[model samples]
Target: MTVEVVIFVLMGLTALGGAITVVMARNPVYSGLGLLGTMLSLAVIYVSQLAHFVAAIQVIVYAGAVMTLFLFVIMMIGVDVAEDTAENLPRQRLVVGVLAAAVVGFAVYLGVSQGFDWVPAASGEPVAEATNGTVQAIGERLFSTWVLAFEATALLLTVAAAGAIALAYFRRRRAVRE
Candidate 1:
């Protein structure tokens, strides 16, 4: 088999394993680590595709910054690591699992039927220069072409943070009163 094919297979396995671990892991920390593995594998895939800027950004932004943040949050929250004490494993899980399977099936069907090709252009055309595809290009596009969407995302994050803080504060206050 070609080296490219081998690399693709390896990355695919890494991604699949990470995805499974993310779902099956009892500890939130392990799940985060699994996601980090997935990100790193994906970055390697991007590098193989000659998307050097994207690959670097993937490693730096996702595997480095985002995963670090996720680990910190998981550490701060301190989830119980025991798998045995997991409650309500049936009805809700079944529903979610069914939905996820349906989505995956539909996606696979669409992919097979459409036969989409995303091969980069091979002609030695001078592509417009881009700064390393860091979070900066993403931010620029978001602020320019998708300003409203960017604002909405920021607003959503703000609301979520506030809500979490409020919930924790209220819970603590109630515990103290009791």
Candidate 2:
């Protein structure tokens, strides 16, 4: 097998294992660690695919900032307490199982219909332009085309963070009043 294939297989397996660990682990901290592993593995895969900018963002934004936030939330919520496993909704497990099965079935159907050939037939197109998958290209597109959407997303995140702080402050105030 080729080196790229080998690396892809290893990274894919690591990502799959991490995802399984995240789902199966009962402890919130362990689950967060698993998620971190998954994100890091995905970043490696992005690097292998020559998406260096995306890989850096994956590591910095997801594995760094997002995972830290997730772990902080877990710690703040009291990691010593186990999650309640009792089903509050009737047939919730059954409904979730059916939904999962449907999703898997649809994925399988799409994959089969699209033919699972990994490598595409080569077109006469030129390969490896300097602009391809570079930080410069990404910045150009982000600022030129998607600038408004990016600004909107930033505003949304700021609003969400402010809302969270407001909620926490109000909760603390209410508890103090009590």
Candidate 3:
């Protein structure tokens, strides 16, 4: 009926398609692309909700940087679809999928039953005159209380990057030797 409703519907479709693509696609790179599409749609949803800062961060961090990392890993690993058929279609995978589905369904039910009572944009009264999003508050908190955790995340990212490079290098070396 309304633009918001339409956007929400589109977002839902985007999420559904992305999830299906992730599970069904033979190519890891295509799966990553699907995830990127979902992330971009989620960013649009955040923007529609007036969460500009979160939308920007979602685009930059998830769609841009993290997707790049994912694509890099996928490319480096280079799993062959033909070789992965029977090995990947295990009972454990089915069980995990069922469990994940149950969890998501329960969460959705709980949210729909309880969360819709609350008014939109009325959750928390604005505390400050500043309309700036969570960035400033987050920066202040990080510098004061969460500096260690923030630095830890950076360190983790550095380690991951180094590991990726090492894996790629080793793969190339093995190829040359073979």
Q: What are the Cα lDDT values of the candidates?
A: 0.83, 0.87, 0.83
lDDT for each residue of candidate 3 in 4-82, tens digit (9 for 90 to 100): 8899999979978997898788788789989988899898898776666798899999999999999889878875635
Mind giving the per-residue lDDT tens digits that candidate 1 earns over 49-155? Answer: 66666888899999999999999988887787444655656688789889999999998888798765554444565356534454566667868999998778989
* Cα lDDT, model 2, residue 16: 89
As a whole number from 0 to 100, the lDDT of residue 73 in candidate 1 is 88
Which window of ten consecutive residues has the lowest lDDT sum in model 3? 123-132
Off by over 4 Å in 2: 116-126, 140-178
How does each model score on TM-score? 0.59, 0.72, 0.61
Badly placed stretches (over 4 Å) of model 1 are 79-90, 117-178
Model 2 Cα displacement at 167 (Å)? Answer: 9.5
Best by lDDT: 2
Q: Which regions in candidate 3 have their CA more than 4 angstroms from the true location?
A: 79-82, 87-90, 108-115, 118-178
